[model samples]
Target: MVSVLSPAEVKLPDGSSTDFANLDVAATAPCLDVVAEAVADLLPWYGSVHRGAGALAQRSTREYEQARETLYEHLGCGPGDAVVFTRNTTDALNLLAHVLPPGTTVVTFDVEHHANLLPWRTPVRIGTPRSPGEAVATLDEALRQVSGPVLVAVTAASNVTGELWPVRELAEVAHRHGARIAVDAAQLAPHAPVDMAALGADYVALSGHKVYAPFGAGVLAGRADWLDAAPPYLAGGGATAGVSADFAVRWHDGPARHEAGTPNLIGAVALATACRVLAGADLSAEAHLVARLRAGIARLPHVEELRLFDAAAPRVGIVSFAVLGRDPDELSTELGRDHAIGVRTGLFCAHPLTRRLLREAAGRLDPSAEPPGAAIRASLGIGTSEEHVDRLLAVLSAPLFGE
Candidate 1:
C-alpha cells in the first residue's frame, strides 16, 4: 500500500525537505553552503535602524550603511551621488520614472528589458541598431526631436541577444542634446565593472542576485538632487518619523527615503561580499571565455542564425544563440533535465530585440512563422568553470536538433 505524505515531507534531489514547491532561481541558486554563511551575518538585529539605540540595531544599521558604501565604491559612485537600495532593477527604474518631472520625454532603444521599457510613460523608442554608431545615432535623433526636459534610458547590454549596446556613446549623445541618461546595468554590471563616470550615464541600476549575490537586494546609483527631491519609493515607519495626530509627517533622508521598513542587512552584506569577490577575478579572462564560447557556438551546424550587434564594441561574458530545426524551449529543457546544463530561454523580457534579431536573420518579417523560439543565453560569472562551457557546447552539438 502507498502512503500519503504532507507536502513538507517531500524529499528533494539529495533527500532534503522543504515546505514550498521549489523551482526558479530562488530555489536552485541558493542551495550552496556559501549562501548560508553569507546570510548569517545579518540576522542578529531586530530593532529599527536609526529609530533605536540598541547595540544589535546599531550594528545592523552599520552593516546596511557599509553595504551601501561598498556598492558606491564598486560602481564608482562619487560623493555628489547617492545609492538607493531597491528590491531589484525594475524597482530602481520605477523610482526614477516616478521622480521624473512632467513633460520629461524619454529616449530609449526598442531592445530593452520590460523594466526599462514600460516605466517611461511616453518614450521615444529608438529602433534596433546594427552597430554602436547606429545605436548612438538613434539616441541622438530621439533627443533632437524631443523639446522638453529629457532622460535617455538605455540597457548597457541586451538581455535577449547578449549584445552590448553603445551605452557610453549613447550617454555622450544624450548629454550633447541637453539630456541626462540612465543605464539599465542589470546585464552589464555582473559581467564588468560599471563605471558611471566613465560611461557618463546620469544613473545606473543593478541587481545583486545576477551578480552572484543571489539576494533580494539591488542598487540605484546616481545624481543626488533628483533623488533628494523626489518622494520615497516605499512608505513605512523607517522611511519617515514624527507623524502627527493631525496627519502630517516628516520623511527620512538619502537612501533611507527609498528604503522603507526593515532593511535586509544580511542580503545587503552578502551582495557586498559577492561584489568584492567578483571584483578581484580576472575580467579579461572571463571575457575571453565568452568570446571563445561565442566563436565555438557560431561554428556549429544547424545554428542557422548568428548575430553580434557590433564587431568592435566591447562586451561582457554572455552569449545568446539560436539553433535551426530546434525549439529553444526544448533545447533548454533537455539541457537542464537530461544534462544538468542551465541557461535562460524565451524573449528575455525584451520582445523588440528578439524580433529584430529574428527578422534580420530571416530576411523578411513573418509574424506567423515561428521565429526561432527566443534565444539560449549562456551567461557566466566569477564562479563559472570551463566545464560549464564545454558541457553547453556538447549539448548544443549533439544530434538532437531534429529530435
Candidate 2:
C-alpha cells in the first residue's frame, strides 16, 4: 500500500472536527510517510555536498548522486540522458528555455499551464483541439511549418481538465519534422507512468510537490548535449573546475554544468524516495477511485464537468467542474469552511483553457451574456479515499449553503 501522511483533523465553522479531505493533490500532494522517514534518516549525516572531505560530506554526496540515478531509472530515461535537479517544474522548463539554441522556434498549445506556455523565445501557439486526433494533427501541421531548430513543448496531462494528451504520437510528429519535444509531466507523473524513452521525448519535466514529495525539488531529465553546452544555471564555486586570479574559469560538464551552488540534498532524497515508491504503486486502484469520484459528481444536479476532449477520453485523477448559479470561489470556500473538503478554484494557472471552457459552459447555459470566470477542481490521488468522495458528494447534495 502507498503510505501517505495521515490526514489532519480540521475544525469546521460549526465547531465540528473532521479529517481534511485533501482533494487538491494536483496542486501539491502531502508528503508520504516513507519520504518523511527518509528525510529523518539523512538529517543526522547532513553536510555540504561535493565539498567537504569528511565522512558526513562523502555520505551526503553519495546519497545525492544515488538519488539522481534513482530518478533516472524511475523515469526510464536513455543511457546518454542526464537528470538536472531544479526547484520545480517551472524552474526546469525555464532552464530549458534559457539554454535553447538561438533563433529556436517553440511550437506549443495555448492551453498549457503558464510554466509551459511562457519562457519560450518564439512560441507558435496552436489552437485548442476538440479531440486527441485533432490535437495531433494541429501539432503536426505546426511543426511542419516551423523550420530550423524547432522545439515542441506540450503537457502530458491537462492540469485543468485532467485530459491526457497523446504524447508518443506528438513526439513522433515532432521527430518527423526534425524537431525535439519536451513534455511537462507535472500533472501526469503523479497518477501515471511516464517513460521518457518509451514516449520518444527528448526531455521531461516534473515537480516533486505534485508526487507526494513536497520538499521544493523537481527534475529535468533528457539529452545532455544542450545542457552541457549552456552556461551554468548559477555561477558558483561548485560549478567551476578551476578559476584564475583574473576571473577566468572553466565549468564542469554533465549535470554539474547546470546545477550550481548548494543543492537541495534533503529535497532530492525525498523526491527520489517518492519516485521509487510510485514506481511500485498500483495506479489502477487510484484510477478506480477517481472513476468513483467522477461518477458521484456526475450524479450531482446543475454540475457541469469540464473537458478538453470527449467525455470518454482517458484522463488522470483530476476533474474540474462549474456549478451553475453558484460562484466557484464562493463554493470552494464553503466546501472548506463548512464541509472540510479541500479543493482548488479559479483558472488553475491555465487561463486560456479555463476561459474557453467557461465560455462553452456559458453558451450551453444561455448562448448570450459573458461566461463565468472561474471553476472548481477536485483532484484525487493515493491519499484520497472513498469516504472523502462520498463526503464531497453528500455535501454538494445537501442544502447547507443553498446549493
Candidate 3:
C-alpha cells in the first residue's frame, strides 16, 4: 500500500480528539509521503521552466519535461500523444472541449459528472443504461444519427455509485461509428491502472488530488493532431514560438501550446511521481476492504446500495447507500461527531445518476416515503485500515438503524 498520511487525529464536535477514519477518499485522497518528499526536495531548486538561463531553470525544464514522460508512460499514450498539464481534471476536459474542431459533436451519457457533461458545445446526451451492453448500444445508435466528426465523452467509473463502466467496449462502439472517445478518468485512474491504447481511448483526463498528489495538478493526454491544428487554449509566453513587436505571434505546437502560462512545476512533479508509483502498486488489500464493506452493507436490510448495474458489476473501493428514513447529512454528521468516522453525504456531483438511483431505491425500500435527495458514501483508500471499515460497519448496524 502507498504510504499516505493516515489515521489523522481530529477534534470531535464535543471537544474530544480521535484518530479520524477518513472514508471520504473519493472526494480528495490524503497525500502520499513519497509525493510530499519529492516536492520538498524540489522547493530549493525550483525555478521557472523554459524561460530562465540559470542552472536551476535548466534543471527545472528537464524535471518538468521528464514529468510529462512519466505520465506518458503511465497511461501508455500513443507515440504522438500530447500530455498537457492543467489545473485539474475540469481544466483538462475544458481544454479538450476548446480544442475540439468546430462543428464536432460531443456525445455523452446523462449520468456523467458535471465536469464531463457541461464542457461540450451542446452535447448529444444518451439516457442511462441498465447494463454495459445497453450503454454501448445506446451510444452506437446515437452516433449513427449524428453526421460529422464526433467525440464520445464518458467516465471510466461512476463517482456516485462506484460501478465501473465498460470504457473499452464504449470505445470500440465509438470507433465502429467513425467517432473517437475521450475518457474522464478522474475517479478511475486512482483505483485502477489505466492504459490508453488498451482502452482504445483517444484522450484521458485525471486530477492529481484524487491520486494522492493534491497540489492543483492534472493532465489531458491524447492525440496531438487536433491540439496542434486548433488554437492555443491559453495565450502567453511559453505557447508562442516567435512574437514580433507588431504582435504577430507564431504559436508552438504540442503540449506547450495549451500550457501557456508559467506551469505548476511542483504540482506536475508530484502528480507524475504519484502516477509512477501507482503503476506498480498492490491494491489487493484495498480490494479486500471494498469486498468487506460491501458485504457489511449487504447484511443491513435497511441499506440500499447505490449502483447503476447489478451488484456483480466491477467497482472501486466506494460504497454509497441510502438508509430507510434516514437523512444522509445527519448520518454523516453523527458518524463524524460520535465515532470519529468521516463519510461524504450529498449528490456526489453526478446529480442525474444519484437522483435516478435514489428514486429507484425509494420505490423498492418504501413506496410511501419520498425519494432521498442524497446518500452516504464511504470510500476506501491506501491508508484505510481494517479497523476503519469495522468501525463504520458497527455504527450503521446499531439499534437506531434497525428496521
Candidate 4:
C-alpha cells in the first residue's frame, strides 16, 4: 500500500521522510528493487564473462556486456566509441593517466578532486581561478604556455561545494588548442545527465558506487584510439587471445583489451539498471529538491558563511560550512548518531580545494591546532529527505556555533 502523501513525503528508515532538500530523487526503494533483482547472480568471486558458455554464465555475460552497451547508449556515444570497465573512478583515471602518451601536459583547476588531479603524469599543476571568468582566463594562459599533445582533465562538478564547472567552455578551450578533454564525472554523473559526446569531452569516467550501484564497477567511456593504442591496464587470460610455448601472446580488441579478466558481471548490470531507473525519474521534481534545500539553508543566519568559496557558483547537492566553535567531526558524528542524519565531513579528498575555502573564511583545519580549522561538508543524495535537511539545520542552530 503506497502512502497517501506526495512522493516527497514518503517515509524511510530511521524515521525520516523522503523530502530531504539535497536528494534529487528518492533512490532507496528503486535501489533496493534493483539489488533484489540481481541478488541471485551476486557472487563473492568474480564470474567468467565473454568466455562463459554455460546457461547461467552465458546469461550473466550477456547482462554484463549489455550493461556496457546500455551505458554507451545512455550517454549518447556514437559509433567507433568504447567503454572499458574499471574498479571505480580512481581506476579509470589511473588508466587514462598511464595511457596518455609520454610527456602529455594535463590542464585542470585546483578545485578538482584528487582523482582528477593525481592521475596526470606530466607537469602536475593547479590552476588558480578566483572566479568563473578568471578560471577561463587561467586556462587560456596555460594553453598558451603548452604547445604539445595535451589532455584537459576536469570535474563536471565539485564534490565539496557542489559547484558546477563550465565543462562545455573548458572543452571548447581544449579543442581550440588541439587538446583532448576527459571529465571526471564521479560526482556529477550521479546527480545530473552526462553525455560524453554531447559534453565535447574526449572521455568521461564515473563510479557505480556513487551512482547507487555500489558493486565495485566503474567505466571509462569515449575515444577509442588512445585506449586501443595503449597497453591493457591489466594483463591476464581474458585480455589475450593466445599464449605460446615461447611466452608469445595475442590480445583482444575493444573493451576486452582493458577488461583483462573475469568482470564484475553483476555490478555492471546493476549500474545499468540504476541508470535506467534514474532516467525515468522526474528531473523537474529533482530540480525542485535542489531549490528547496538552497532556500532552507538560506534561512539559517550562519549559512551565508559557507558560501565563501564561490558564492555565485551553481551548486549541485552539497553544502559545506564551518561552525563558529564546533569541530566538524563532532558535528558530523552527532548528526549521524543523535539526529540520524548522514552527512560527509572533513576535507572530502580535495585538500587544496577545501583549504582554499577554509583559508578565506579565517578558519583552521584542526580546531585544536595552533589555529582553529577546516569546514563541515553536508552532501545529499537522492535517498535524502526533507526532514533530514530540517533536522540538520535545527541541530546546527542549537548553540553549536557558540554565540
Please, what is the whole-model Cα lDDT of each candidate in the order they appear? Answer: 0.71, 0.89, 0.90, 0.71
For residues 1-403, what per-residue lDDT tens digits would candidate 2 score against the true structure? 7778865689988888989899998998988899999999999999989999998999999999999999999898887899999999999999999889888999999899999998898999999899999999999888777798999999999999999999999999999999999999999998878899888899999999999999999999998888888888889878899899999999999888888889999999999999999989887877787788788777766666888899899999899887776777888898898888999998999898898897786666557646667988999988688899888888777574355
- Report clash pairs, candidate 2: none
Which regions of candidate 2 fall more than 4 Å away from where they truly are?
Answer: 366-370, 398-403
- Model 4, span 163-248: residue lDDT tens: 77878888888899899999988878767788876789889998877777767788898888888888878999778978899998
Give the candidate order by descending lDDT: 3, 2, 1, 4
Q: Which sections of candidate 3 miss by over 4 Å?
A: 13-17
Error at 389, model 3, angstroms: 1.3
Worst window of 10 by summed lDDT in candidate 1: 20-29
What clash count goes with each model? Answer: 1, 0, 0, 9
Q: Tell me the tens digit of each residue's lDDT in model 3 across 1-403.
A: 5689765588877888878899999899989999999999998889989988998999899899999999999998978898999999999999999999999999999999999999999699999899988998899899989989999999998888888999999999999989989999999988898899988999999999999999999999999999999999998879999999999999999899999989999999999999999988888898789899999888886777888898899998889888876787888888988989989999988888888898887777778768777888999888888999999989888655654
What does the lDDT read for residue 115 in candidate 4? 88
For model 2 the local lDDT of residue 216 reads: 91
Q: Residue 168 lDDT in model 4?
A: 85
Question: Which pairs clash in model 3?
Answer: none
TM-score of each: 0.86, 0.97, 0.97, 0.86
